[model samples]
Target: MKVGVVLPVFNQEPQYIFECIQSLQNQTFRQFKLAIVIDGANAETVNAVYEASQVLTIPFQIINRTENQGIAYTLNEGFSYLTDCPYLTWVSSDNRHYPEFLQALVKTMDSTPKEIVLVYSLYHRINEEGINVSNSEEMHQFMTSLMRRPKEQIYSVCFLGASFLFRRQAFEKAGGYRNKFPIAQDHDFWMRILQHGDIYFLEKYLMEYRVNGKYSLTTLTPSEDLILESMRSSIDNRKTIQDIPKVSVLLTSYNQCKYIDHAIESVLNQTFTNFHLIAVDDGSTDGTQEIIYQKKDSRLIGLFLNHRGKAHALNAGLEFCLGEYVLELDGDDWLDPQTLDIMVREMDKQPPNVGLTYANRKLWNQVGEKLIEGPIIPGLNYGDKYDVLSNLQTHCPRLYRKSALKSIGGWKRFIDGQPAILDDFLMFLDLAEKYDFHWINGALYHQRRHEKNITLIQQEEISSEIQKIVHAKIKEWGNEYIPEFIFNEGSLVKVDLRPRGLS
Candidate 1:
């Protein structure tokens, strides 16, 4: 039941060292052991550590090494001696834990289901002078946002902050800290260990992470190459496939050569591999078809058709879909690796009548050559026929039952004889009429907005088309389908509707 803590020290300031050790000494829960690993310390640092170790009343050990190995090596060396402790965690020299840090983490780990092998808590970001830099409320909101992501996404997002505890078994299974990604060792380790078991997030702030500019490893930025290599390795290692796909993704594009490859790769690299990608190119004269043919994944099926609009291209892709659920992805957009896994799992939990499930989306503006992140468009929890018709951009990463989609005659050119610019919206309206819609909370879809985007190029035309469709649908469904408007003063404020006849 004892917790093992490793404090890895390089050339940190003596005052910080004393304060860190004092934090441990004053812990509310005392059934813990500390290992102070001094990695090639200078004479002053070694003496300072010796002086700081005097105040510790608990059982502790100091491991001194002559060579200046990095954090990963030092961590491995320190944990090697704490084999008797069931729970293990490591702390940085510049950080200080709250008195209840060890107590709360141990309690949570003890109470958590056996499937969860690790637990992490929120932490306060402090300046060099120990002044809190981040607002408490803001930090809580930020951490809560990260907590919404499923563990399947750990490879892409690292929500495990400074304060964390893991079972020794998980540590052993992960093979300890890796030396490969020296700067991103913790993130790499988290990705590897997550494969073995789930991680629990404790919402309390339990530690003060000191941002001591040059003295802290947190300030060091890992090279983008290193990050990409680490992510690629982690993703490749975690790839799992099912013999039968549960979902089929239809990625349709037209002259999107610049972004098509990334979109295809995003679908192929998804953590949930039980889906096939049907990438349809609608006569791209800009080499988009060439990139689609170049990809060699067995799960990918490439189709090059004559110049047709998106609706036609989607219907073409639909002809090859072999999954129970279908998702349509724009070629200029990509997805989070965990999108399929999370959406499929969520959809499976709903009733058969819930034919559609979608998640939030991240907006990106692709100017000339740069891509800039915009605000996240949160998905509506429940969308009725009214919401679908009113909101132009409803939800994304929309995973729908293939049977339901087929029953409604798939995608259609709802506008003139030509393809409809609001094809997705039209599809949504058709699906909304026959089935219910559910929403998941994470920003799983990456929507890129550029000059070449259809929605942007034909905004006025799309608006006019949407209005015509809405009026026609309202007329067809009669008074029950027409929305009742609530007016404030002289302006209209809200529209209320009770749609209850389709079931």
Candidate 2:
């Protein structure tokens, strides 16, 4: 089982290039070849590649070009040269592969079905000197379980940056990478090949992805909107509903005229375009109804109601849903752009027992300008029945299975004198008996905190509602509920209400 590895370097340091070559040379599985392509690298890098090829014992193929054609063209040249190898993958110049990287990928591909085009393993991000700079250690178990189901739709970049061994046939079938996506060429290629065949995730650490600390901690394409639009085009032209929507996004607003536009735009610009959006105006006297009618998008289903409370408005939106999953967003708050897509994909990978998955979120100051703090679930595993009963965790930004939600009788109708948004908590309590919940690590929602917010009621009233809800659920579900934060604890939770910060 021989494989081809393409190393595309551009303006990278010679030492980093050597580190890459040495890492490949040290692989446990030896049946592989390195196709080194230098795209506008400095003199030192070109010299180093040439020098390393002479000393390396593995099969070496170097394509050093004189002019600086972008990474897309350089990678294509390397891909064209790999016609002799059956398996394919590429790595950045600054990253290094583990000894078992090739072995793990080959071993998995050999055991799996032939239709699996690529098998990408978990990778860590390292800085210039190759020091680990992230919490990748914690995600090992969490992500391993998440990737078992391969039918999910991907919104943003989730695969190992450049750490997969792909089938050569699939590459040709997908027409290779597109040059128009300067930085997102690989992601574009991934999207294309995913349509051709399934992708397998190997749960081993295969490589280290280098990050440009000078620019950003991550390597997402700067032109993400362009990539999203290109992906949308592919969906738009699909012959069948296989790639069509399986999720519905609901945003209910009463008088959020000032903030409603941004909320609507966020949903409209999602990378995963399959889901339908229903924005209910809840009979706002303000210009919120006008704003809802302004979008004129086919995916958007705007409905106007007569000053109904949030519970009534949300149920109205749910009535028109055609998708299997539902994403709940607030009228005053906006999503992280990728929230709907990522959550829907994550939910797709879940088992029958797992009915919902929520992600971490960012809390913003009044007017939603400054990012005051970033918040994550207390732990990755805090979604069980007992965990939910505990007053420690608050759940929001939830993506739910439409069937499960409907089976549970949809949103709990809010009665007067109830804590604001307590209906959501009641809905979750009932769902907890029959379904499971999972948490994703990334913070993708922006929660606005201000005087006019719905959940900003008095602390004593909130505490009373939460205490009543938790104890009632405990009795109903036969689970012990004990909270960590006791009397005099700060950071604002319901005095009696069951709510989390910024949810």
Model 1, runs deviating above 4 Å: 222-226, 229-233, 239-503
lDDT of each candidate versus the true structure: 0.80, 0.71
- Give per-residue CA lDDT, model 2, range 41-112, as digits (tens): 778778988876676788877887889988778878898887888888888777889999999998898888
Error of 1 at 212 (Å): 4.4
The alpha-carbon root-mean-square deviation between model 1 and the true structure, to one decimal in Å, is 18.3
- Tens digits of per-residue lDDT, candidate 1, 1-503, equal 39889999888788888888999999999998989999997877788889998999999999988789988999999998899999999998778899999999999999999899999988888898889898677666856776655676664445577889999998898899877777778878887788789988888889999985467765565433344444444434445323346888989999998999899999999999988787878878999987876565556666677776788888877866778899889999999999999999999998988888999999999988999999998987545676766554557988989988888999877565655777777888888888998889899999999887766676557556665676677776674665554544544334455564754
Clashes of 1: 0
lDDT value, candidate 1, whole model: 0.80
Worst 10 residues of 1 by lDDT: 235-244
Per-candidate Cα RMSD to the true structure, in Å, reads 18.3, 19.1
| Poorest 10 consecutive residues by lDDT, candidate 2 | 151-160
Best by TM-score: 1
Clashes of each: 0, 16
